[model samples]
Target: MKEYIDLFNRLPNLIILEDEPLARYTGFRTGGPSTVLIPTEESSFVEAYRTIINNHIPFFVLGNGSNVLALDEGFDGVVLVTKRALNHISVDETTITSGSGISLSELCRVALNHDLTGLEFAYGIPGTIGGAVYMNAGAYGSEICNVLNKVVYLDENGNYREKNLSELDLSYRHSIFQAQKNWIILSASFSLEKGDHDTILGKMNELLNRRIEKQPLDYPSCGSTFKRPVGSYASKLIDECGLKGFSIGGAAVSEKHAGFVINKNKATTSDILELCHYVQHIVKDATGFDLELEIEFLK
Candidate 1:
């Protein structure tokens, strides 16, 4: 660990912090600390990432930290925060190119400003563009693959490469990035259409309102605890199994949305994990359908 820290410290213009708390960065708001690296420039980020990988040091690339639950014991390696160095947006007519670190909401705002449609479905998604593309994030019958044209990423050999939409192999909450662990998303190009500004804004607001009405927006939670099972909805199954409002330690199945397990009273990562497992077990036993988690767990 000392050697790893020393190697990271040698990278110029990179900000290294010891025992940095991760709760403040994640939506769950409950996690322990880890060694965090924040690069001030793209060159520094490339150097830091290469150095870590070449030295076989354990590391994870992080975006907005939305759809992940870091364990109580914390990550024992480096946390590379992409937002610190890779946030940039550019518009070329109806095409928009964005860095992976930029937030989905901010991207939507950019589209709205340029009268670009096709990104309205992402208006309220609380995640970075990288995570969105990696997960093929979607809402209201639309997904990121709808507008994505190409992606620039770091290959396994620390070489930068680009892939077009067809090669991405995108599907419901799955992408080629999930299968290739060493592929690090850097930026993406999206093809949109020109539309009326007022109409686009109205659609975005309508979707935001619907999300607020159906989701537990006020609570600290990874949105939608389980994936929508084929021919069934995970939330409906949990609700039917009488798991809504169920409590385990400081965690509870949200009364407003059975899909969410929220930190109602400073819940620990263990509490959330236990509660999610219990919900999955009960829902499966009752409905004969296995509930797959939508959020990733980091340990």
Candidate 2:
């Protein structure tokens, strides 16, 4: 690992940092310092992985950092940040191609600019392309699966390849990535439909406006805390159990939306986890429904 650090110091395309705060990098703004941080450029990403493999060092890929809850102890292993560095977007008529690190909101805007209509439903979602594809993220009855044609990824063996949408097994906030280990999404192709620019912009505005009006956007959160159960909404279940506005330390279920657990003020990762567990337990006890977490816990 020391030799790998030395090698990284010599590599121009990679920037390495030690004892860096994971909080500053994540959307939640709530973790301690990480042992090592590496931001690699497109030309250096594969090489960076090779170096980690050769050195037998544990490493994890991170994008936008929106859907994660990093512990206060932080990550002890190597943290690979792919945001900004891998952000690339290209659009051609009804197709949009984006790098894994590209933000979903940015991709939606790109589609809007190109007069593409299918992505308007995702206009206000925060997170990167790879994160969206991995979770098969959805909103307003539209999902990544609806527009995804195929995805290009680095397989478990670190070989580059592509797969069709049908092969991904995308379903209700889950994808093949959930079961498959060691694979990293590199990019994806999305198929959209052509529409009038004004109409596309109108739809985008409507979705964004709805999100702002209904969600607690003023506070920090990992968005929705739980996935919707079959034929039921998690928020409705929690609300029926009177979990809304419930607090655990600094974390609280949003007064505005029962689905979200927000950092009301200086909330710790522990607080969020506690609130999530409480909600799950209460909802299960009251309604016999097991609420599955949508947020990814990172430690």
Candidate 3:
């Protein structure tokens, strides 16, 4: 513990907190405290990451905390927040380069302002650019891989590097980043085409409205709980099994959207995990389709 604190203190101009409550950082709003480090500058981020790697300490690179569920016991390592430090966005003609911490919604607004049309599908997706690229986030028949040109990342040895879109192996909510656990996403570049600003904004607004109407946005959730299975929707299967509005503790299957598991009250991590496993078992037993979770469970 002394070694960890000493290393953390070496990086100046960084927000270091001990046993910081994690629920405030995540979308589900239910988790315990963790040792968190928030770097406000790019140089500090690099220094902090390098120091953590050198010390052989366990750590998690967190973005907007949109698609993760931290356990009730909480993480026992460094939780590095990249959102505040790496949030810059620059436009070069029709191409957009953004820091990994920028939110999808914010990126969409930037694209619309620049008269770019390809990112309308991601307007309402609640995740950072880094997490979206890592998961190949998609909606409305389009994915981030379609527009990604290249990405900057930190290798296992704490060396900075870049990879083209073709090297990312992006497909169906999977990316090379999953396999390369040590590689940390830093920034990404997207190639888009110019379009009428009003047209782009109109499409973005339509998608946002669709999400607001169809999804249970009023409640706290990690977006869609389960991924869409091959040739069928996960929501339809759960709805068919009559699991909608099923409550286990404070966690409940959303009444509005069967695909979501929401924190309807003061839910615990155990409650959510139990509810997920229950849904998976019931769905598999009834339909013979094994439901896979989309949210990453952080223990």
Candidate 4:
């Protein structure tokens, strides 16, 4: 691990920070330190990513870190950051191809700029294209699978490959990526329709306003805390269980939106995990519904 990290540091235009705090990269803002690699160039990023994958080095590919909760003790391996490095987006007629690092907000803006429609559901999301692809991010009765045409990714062997939309196994807040953790997303293309710019802008604004009005955006969170169980919504269930505004240490269920678990104060990783567990327990005892977490807890 040390040898490859040192080698990555020597790669031109690659920014390598040893023993860097995970809090600086993640939205939770409550984790210890690890070695983080921030790619400044595409070639360097690709080389480092391939090396880490092919050599079986312990590593995690992080996007905007809006959906991950790192452990308090932090990771012992490398964290590959792909925010500014793999940021590329292009339009080909009605198809839009974007690198995994591009923020969802920017992607929506680009779609609107091209007078394209179908991605407004993701307008207010703070995650990156990579995270959205991995989780099949959705909102307002729409999901990424509805428009995604294909995915270009690096297989477990660190070889570039492309897969059609049908092969991704996309579902509500789930994707094949969860089962194939070693497979790294590179880019994806979405099929959209030419629409009136004003119409697209209006749709985007509507969803953004909905998020702002209902969510506790002032605090750090991994968006919704739990997946909606069959025949019921997680937020509605928690609200029924009287778990909203419940707190453990600095972590609390959002009073504004029961679906979210926010870092209310200076929360610790333990605080967040414990609070989530408490909510799950209470909700299950009250309603008999199993509440599965939507956020990824990284150790």
Best by lDDT: 3
CA lDDT of every candidate:
0.91, 0.84, 0.92, 0.91
Lowest-sum lDDT 10-residue window in model 3:
1-10
**lDDT of candidate model 4 versus the reference:** 0.91
**Which candidate should be chosen as best, given TM-score against the real structure?**
3
Q: Look at candidate 1 and give me any clashing residue pairs.
A: none
User: Candidate 1, which segments miss by more than 4 Å at Cα?
Assistant: none
Give lDDT tens digits, candidate 4, residues 123-232.
99999999999999999999999999999998888789999999999999999999999888989999999999999999999999999999999999999989989999
TM-score each candidate: 0.98, 0.95, 0.98, 0.97
Better of 1 and 2 by TM-score: 1
Across 215-294, the per-residue lDDT of candidate 3 in tens digits comes to: 99998899889999998899999999999999999999999999999999999988999999999999999999999999
- Deviation from native of the Cα of residue 109 in model 1, angstroms: 0.8
How many clashes (backbone atoms < 3 Å, residues ≥3 apart in a chain or on different chains) does model 2 have?
Answer: 0
Clash pairs for candidate 3: none
State model 1's lDDT: 0.91
TM-score of candidate 3 versus the correct structure, residues matched by position: 0.98
Give the distance in Å from residue 281's predicted Cα in candidate 4 to where it truly belongs: 0.6
Q: Can you give the lDDT of residue 161 in candidate 3?
A: 99
Candidate 1 lDDT tens digits, 202-288: 999999999999999899998998999999998899999998999999999999999899999899999999999999889888889
For candidate 1, the TM-score is: 0.98
